[model samples]
Each structure stands twice: as C-alpha cells, then as structure tokens.
Target: MSLPLDSPALALRAAIHGALAADAPLAALLGGAKVFDVPPKEADFPFVALGEAVVADWSTATERGTEHALTLHAFSRSGGRAEAMAIAAAVQEALHDMPLALAAHRLANLRATTAEVVRDPDGRTFHALVRFRAVTEPL
Candidate 1:
C-alpha cells in the first residue's frame, strides 16, 4: 500500500517547504526560489529542492514513531559560497529546533544535523545541503 498523508516523511517535508516559503529572511535572500519535491529540470538558478527522506521505525510498545533523516538542497549560480552560505544559514535558522504542526502526525521534534556548502563540479553552481532529524508519532 502507498504511504498515507499522515506519514511522518511527507508531513516533515511539507512543514519545511511551508516554513521556507513563509519566511521573509529566506524570501529576501532567494527572491522566489522555487521549492520542489523533486529537482526542477527547466527552472532557473537559486532553487530549493526537498531531497531524500530516510525513515526508520522509532517506536515503543505504547506509541509508534518515525525517525526521519531529511535532506534539503539549495542551488545557486551567483554570489558563490557567500550566497549559498547565506541561503544555507536561512535554511538552518528556519528549521533547526523549529516546531511543526503535521497533518495527521505529531511532530515530537525537528533539528538540523548538518549544513554544508559545496562547490559544484560545474564550477559555477553552488550546492548547499541542509540535513535534519525529525521524530514524529501518530496524533
């Protein structure tokens, strides 16, 4: 069977997308960077992609929970590391230790695990990887 909307993975992703889209600091820095569940093919630079979600069973006999390993990517073409770093900072600020209201699941917590800015092999593209850990349980 397919995963439900209440799936911790989906809820966590949506929460992140919503937070980034609604944050003024992020908007000012990226200026309409499209956030996507998958990397866009024909989109312009400075886009945000919701990357992988690795979920594992983190449950007790009394409750069922999921530990989600999440990655969000930011791509930039200009301003080099400085620009990517700024955007990455915003991502971290927006997400780390932030509370999220999940659809059908309860978010126990969300915290950033790592934030790294890497120079793409293309030489002109900058890649920012933002990783997080989220624990969620049924509502």
Candidate 2:
C-alpha cells in the first residue's frame, strides 16, 4: 500500500527541517538559514542539506510505529574541516534528543547517532555527515 501524505517519514523530515532552519546557533554557523532538502545549483558553501533517509517498520504487537534513520550533510570550503565540523556540531545540538512536532505522529524519541567529517573529492571542500535515529508512533 502507498504511504499517506503525512507519513511518519515525511512528517519527521518536515519537523527536522523546521527545527534546523529556526535554530539560532545553527543558522549562525551557516551564516543564515541555509537548510535545504535540495540545494540550488549555485548554492552557497557552509550550508546544511537534508540528505538520505531510511524508514522501517517499528510497530509492536499493540502499537503502530516507525523508525527513521536520517542523514544531514554540511558543506564548507573554509580551507579546513573546522567550519564543517562546527556546522555538524550545531546540527547535533539543534536536533539530538530534542522534541519535534510531527503531523499525524508523535515523536517517541530522537537522537544524533553519529557524525563524520571528510574532504570532498574535489580536494577543496570539507563535508560533514550527521546521522540521526528517531522513533515515532501515530497520534
């Protein structure tokens, strides 16, 4: 069956985007609210983009639920990994264990699982990957 428009994944993504976009510390690190699901062709550096997400059935015998594994990417060209790492830290601070308002679902838990910083293929860019795990139950 097709998932509903307000599926847990979609709702969770929207809530996450909203939270990151509104976080003052994250915005400051990014120089502005540069959180995007799809960054523009000419998107600025040092921005955060919502990356891949995997959803799985987390339902129990009694309760319907979903588990989400989501990834967020931070990009920087500041000559080192510092900027990218800082952006990743801000993202973790903004999201880890934080409550989010998800439409048609109630967030059971959310936490930043892991983060890594690496140089991009071009050799001039630093990329930070932040991953989060979340559980949700239908409202």
Candidate 3:
C-alpha cells in the first residue's frame, strides 16, 4: 500500500517518448528520436517537446483511475509548414490507439483527440500541437 512515484503526467510523457523513439517514421521525421520535456540549447529542428497536462480524477465504483489532457509539441526550423505537418502526421499515427507501458499504473486507454499545425510569428519556424486523452488505473 505504498504511494506510486510515477504520476499520471510522468507515465504519459514516458509513453510518448518511448512511442516516438520506437516509431521509424517519426524517428526519421525528427532526424532521430528527439523527444524531450525540455529541448537542449540550440537543439536540432524537427524535435518534439512534451507540454503541460491537465489531469483529473476518474475514480469508478470498483477502481481508481484518471483522465488526462496532454499536449505534444513539434518544432521545426528547416523552413515551411511541410516538414512540420509531416512530423505531426507521424506523431499522430504513432500514438493513436497505440498501447503504452506505465511504470506505476495501468493504461486503460490512450488516443489522440485533436491536432493543429501553424507557422510561428517569426515566419521561419513551424509549430504543431497534438492533443491526446488517456485513461489510467493504479496497478
């Protein structure tokens, strides 16, 4: 009856990182698996960042669970929206309905909800935001 160290947020981020790193399509799009919670100094273009997650309790009569609101960001500086859009597609395809492992909980379900691609005000960078929902229960 010990408390779990892997919060819903941590589990979700780890799943995303693992999924993207393992997907060849997404790996190639980013020129490598470049998933991170924080991008490095002068990090390479076409990388991914795990953004904020708004979570809520989803307890049932028989089990404890959670519903997550997650955001994944794709960034590009190689110019144009094409690369960004393609990477976004790969991200969505990689995670949609795919299974993920949780360190301290069970992932009841995971699915992409919505996504959008846009050019930044700098006109040279492209940004794509992908959103997802997940249901988890304590293991």
Candidate 4:
C-alpha cells in the first residue's frame, strides 16, 4: 500500500486558525478576526500570528500518533504589555482543552503550556508568546 500523505501539524494549524478566527470573544478583543499565518507588511497592531511548531512521533504498539508543540505570537502597539497579555489570554481561553477538527487525524488533547509577555526593543511595541502542546492520532 502507498504511504498516507497527511501532516498532523499542518492540519492542527489550520484548525487552530479557523477556531481563532471564528471566536467572537477573540474577535472583539482584536477588533476583528485578525489572525494570520503571515500577517501583511501593513497589518494592524494587536493581532495574532501563527508561529513555529514542532511535531514528533507518538505512535503506540497499535496506534499511530504525534505530539505537537506550537507557538502563537500576539503583537500590540499599546503603551504597555496589557494589550498583548490580554490577547494572549483570549487565545488561551479560545483554545485550551477545546476540540479541533484535524484532517486525517483526531486531536486527543490540547493544552496551553506557557505564555510570556515582553516589551519589544522598539520600546513601543509589546509581544506575547504563547505555547501549546497537543497530541494527535491518525483516524
């Protein structure tokens, strides 16, 4: 049989993007559904962008699976880190322990691992890095 061609990481990212884009609370906080895999050069501040992701085999004796570690970045031009932190919190609320429909795979579990906010070197921009861990099994 030919090998199946499916990427759990990519599927997970797409599901995450869709979920965040459709979250009314997150939309209200960001002023819109300003979630992007690659934000435009002129993209507005206080937006969420998909960041890096790492996936590893998690197969069992009879199950094929993968574990994923993903990062999401929140950027804001507010005077302080409050906006960035708030955006990060909203992302966590929108995703943590939530079910995501992945192509060719099933999301076993997803959890927010950590979040950190910092002032950018520009001195006017704030950034928050939120990380999540998830396990996926082939369908």
Decreasing TM-score order of the candidates = 2, 4, 1, 3
Pairwise lDDT winner, candidates 3 and 4: 4
Of candidate 2, the 10-residue stretch with the lowest lDDT total is 1-10
Q: Model 2, residue 101: displacement in angstroms?
A: 0.6
User: In terms of TM-score, which candidate is stronger, 3 or 4?
Assistant: 4
Candidate 1 overall lDDT versus native? 0.86
TM-score of each: 0.93, 0.97, 0.91, 0.95
lDDT of 4 by residue, 88-117 (tens): 999999999999999998999999999999
Give the alpha carbon lDDT tens digit for every residue of 44-112 in model 3.
Answer: 888988888888999988889999989999999876888888888888899888878878888888888
Q: List the residue pairs that clash in candidate 3.
A: none
lDDT of each: 0.86, 0.95, 0.86, 0.93
Candidate with the greatest TM-score versus the true structure:
2
By TM-score, is 1 or 3 better? 1
Q: Which stretches of candidate 1 lie over 4 Å from their true place?
A: none
Note the residue pairs that clash in candidate 1: none
After superposition, which runs of candidate 4 have C-alpha atoms over 4 Å from their true positions? Answer: 1-5
lDDT of 1 by residue, 27-78 (tens): 7887874677776588777878889889999999888999999999988999
Displacement of the residue 72 alpha carbon in candidate 3, Å: 0.3
User: 1-139, model 2: which lDDT tens digit per residue?
Assistant: 8778989999999999999999999999888999999999899988999999999999999999999999999999999999999999999999999989999999999999999999999999999999999999999
